[model samples]
Target: MTELGYAQAPAVAAREGVPRPCLGCGAPMAVTADAQLHADATLTCGFCGRSETMPAQAAAQDRYLRLRLMQVRRAREGMEAPLKTYEMMRASGVFALIVFGAQGGWMLWGAFTTADKGSAVFGMLGAAGMMGVILANFGMMRAFRKLIKPLQQARPPAAPGLAARCRSCGGDLPPVRSTHATCAFCGANNFLDNAAAHDVNALLTAEQQDYKVRASGGKPGDNTIYQRPAHAFYVWGAAGAAVTFVVGVVLVLVLV
Candidate 1:
């Protein structure tokens, strides 16, 4: 669980270069400085064609965006830490179970073979208890995974640059405000290289391209046809292609 709090909204200032995840498509949406100055600004997602109007200086709106972004970043970081622990525990558990099985099997075999019925019963009970404990551990881990299942599924692929992601925690690095940018998700400080520092816009461009590829199924470009109001164009294009095929067939038949 992650919580985010914001201070009182200040006078409208030029706040640009902040990317918020879209509610409709989860793609990154840029909040322009225009949004800050104006009474209302419409944010349209480039990926899914979802548009929503946001008030420029409303206190509640200001708080909501900041809170939502903070929650997203914190939730991502929270799930990542536990997931790493779960992986390590799973590997150790597998090795522990293997050793337990081997030793328990031998102990039971020896007790049963010799004329020691009491020892055999004790060995059997111990083995059952150990197995029960191992199963319980696995069950708990399974539940933990299930708890964070939605986060895992919604996790976006890392953007294609060192500057685009945090060095420590693999979360998306926030825009560089200075020489070094502190990760919102993880507290690690990432120093931007000279090239990256000079070309901060490149990071946003890379992320937008990545989003286009995802939304367009590996074809990255203007994908408005997939969005509403443009679906008719796609239909018309298909119909035109069919008509062209029929026209070519008729031409070939007459010429032959």
Candidate 2:
């Protein structure tokens, strides 16, 4: 024994496999968690009564996982953005329609009553500008449709990853290492010393997976969620419809 009831050998041996050789004795070493589940591995030598602590284990050193997290994209959470947009465009469309109508009336009065070219030209240009606004709003409505479609989709949660690998063999490892694991490729023992980052990450993954499975509207294992339409869709739709009405009126007057 070295200092306490521990062995005099290094905490970990240079070579290894699951049930790695203990430092003091040639017996296999295994890692286990304590009662709290908040600590590192309590490495115990099976042959000799020796113990030591280990660092947090990492996983998937070579390969990478792009995990799409599960989360509910609330419909009302950011409604303000689209709502404000709708209000502005709708107001502009209404103002343009009124201006265009008044200008058209003035231009018609000037044309029949007298050849006052200044008033006629002014009215014509003013009406043209209002018409342009109505057309621009139409284009905005089309783009807004594309934006709202995704809001109708079930949004997955944000996904984040970490750099991980087996401490002993530098091999890929599973997320959960509670009881610990032995590598099949290198026969190296893996520990489940839950570090802060890894513990939270694994817990989140498990919870999200379960949530997706439960929220699914299909079969037992199907993944689905309620997708809400964006508020912007309604807003833009109202503005677009308003502009279309005014444009139709202007066209009728021109044709007449």
Candidate 3:
């Protein structure tokens, strides 16, 4: 028995239904049985738009429908990649170093000033301020790195075929013989002529699935579907910047 508690081979076969040829492209329609017994059956064709209901004894049809659903689930999961730890650490480290250097410069200038006792007190306060900034910057860097590390480490799915289903028309776009090729359905130019092909993979990492789904499409499920990690990065970066700016203002007012 597999993890779902059914025999793997037969259960899979039971889930998959009969194949029907597509009317548009002659591609085969894959069908599967819905888990809910006695429920109305549905069919989904990966290559064309064709669906039909099956009679009660349509075991083969059920299997085909289930297989299609399985494929979709896998594809959706594959779209979301993972975050890399090294990349997160590197970004955070750079931010920390920059903030630390700036604070250090401010402190060094305070040491050289020749003023009265009040000036000396202010100088000491400035030194303390620099230390506080250094610590705060380091903390911020650590927090940001931790938050995004899991996202960076996610693995992407295998690349799709040259001809992919168009988001707008749901039609396949075949590759051009030449480097410059335009999508037949939508007239969108394929990036073949460019240095790299366009990646249609999902943008969010596996760990951020829940957050991405919620923030983006408001999907009720726990999984997230982001088109790109950079989107998440921008959102996080903006929030972090706003917080840092507010903290810096408070500190400057208190110290100066």
Name the best candidate (by lDDT): 1
In model 1, what lDDT does residue 153 have? 24
RMSD of each predicted structure: 23.7, 19.8, 15.6
Candidates' lDDT values, in order? 0.48, 0.44, 0.42
lDDT of 2 at 37: 25
At residue 249, give the lDDT of candidate 1: 39
Residues 170-234, candidate 3, lDDT per residue (tens digit)? Answer: 33445446644433323333333222343334432432575577688775632332322444444
Model 1, residue 209: C-alpha shift (Å): 25
Worst 10 residues of 2 by lDDT: 64-73
- Candidate 2, residues 1-256, lDDT tens digits: the string is 0111112111222223345678898887775433222334466787788987653442111111101000011212223234345546656777777877687667757754775555555555555555556655665555444554322222111344532344333444455535455433233334444333355556557656756876885335211111112243344445654665466446535543
Candidate 1 Cα errors over 4 Å, as ranges: 1-80, 155-256
Q: At residue 168, what lDDT does model 3 achieve?
A: 23
* Colliding pairs, model 2: 17-187, 17-188, 18-189, 59-165
lDDT over C-alpha atoms for residue 73 of model 3? 36
